[model samples]
Target: MHLLIAWCGFVGAWLLFAGPIYQAATELEEEGFERDAFSAQIDTVEVPERPSPWWWLLPPVGYVLQRRRQTEYRRRIMAVMTQDQLERMVAFANTATGWLFVAGGAFFIALKETWELAEVYELSVLLFVLAVVVMFALCALHTIVRLRGTHQMLARSGTARNRDSMTDEPPATSDA
Candidate 1:
């Protein structure tokens, strides 16, 4: 009973705040990255591929390992990737956040039930399913709110990159 209440509270807080928390953290991390990136020699720029769907199947352990890989990949990419590429990857990860929550919650419940750490297995599963639904809804809505700004930034950087290559002289206007 007490465990269930605690779990519910955690889920509620996550639904209400996780998206903004993720966005803020990523934004802050980007600041330092931008600084170091300017000085670094760029021999190669390797864009990261999205992970395969097999991740969720491994349940609890897979999530941790996948996250570690994600961090490593992000760090590596930030060292050389363009602003548009970095932000686009971040946005894609943001969109996938809800599944991480769902996998984590469900895996916890499964582990607890297997070890007899908690009772009421059926109810726990049901609650977690509902929580997953709520998480998906909240994250989707948050993504919608944030997508435009991220996309605009990407567009700006892309245009800037293209403009940087052009000759300084302005394009001649056609005579009317």
Candidate 2:
């Protein structure tokens, strides 16, 4: 099911954003440059393919999956964490979970578009610039969210670990 969603995302992105841009780039290159001059060039400028429209669907699908996973994760945490800690863990994971789908969609979409324009210099350059800006923005935002989630996880983990260590601590006997 996940694979199907991913494939749909890949194909949709190719069809929608990457394909048209690539077609445009190819046609543009053919206009002025000689077939061999443009053809033989190892690399070309191009925009990153637009992310898959199907990728838009990923959010809901991923949400369902995360909710399912959350149940299991909570079960595991039950033994070690306080109720508050468990709540924090679920909330933290939930917050950044959406980005996974977003990134996946963007990656697949961008890859499809970029891969086709591998040789069109001007087109490739334009695509690359656009892709870099967009990708960087996506990545920077995702990273910040993930870091926050991680910090929350670490806090809970530390609390759990301390509880364990305390359990292991021997009683201090009074010296008579």
Q: Which candidate leads the pack in lDDT?
A: 1
lDDT of each: 0.58, 0.53
Off by over 4 Å in 1: 1-12, 19-22, 25-124, 149-176
lDDT of 1 by residue, 39-155 (tens): 352435454565666877878767876787788765875766777757765665665575466545654544443333224343566665665566556655676666667778999
Could you tell me which residue pairs clash in candidate 1? Answer: none
TM-score of each: 0.28, 0.29
Residue 68, model 2: Cα distance from true site in angstroms: 16
Worst 10 residues of 1 by lDDT: 111-120
Give me the overall lDDT of model 2. 0.53
Candidate 2, number of clashes: 12
> Which TM-score value belongs to model 2?
0.29
**Candidate 2, 53-163: lDDT as tens digits:** 564478987666666666665454355455665565455445445444454565566675454443333356676667546645554555456556766998999999999
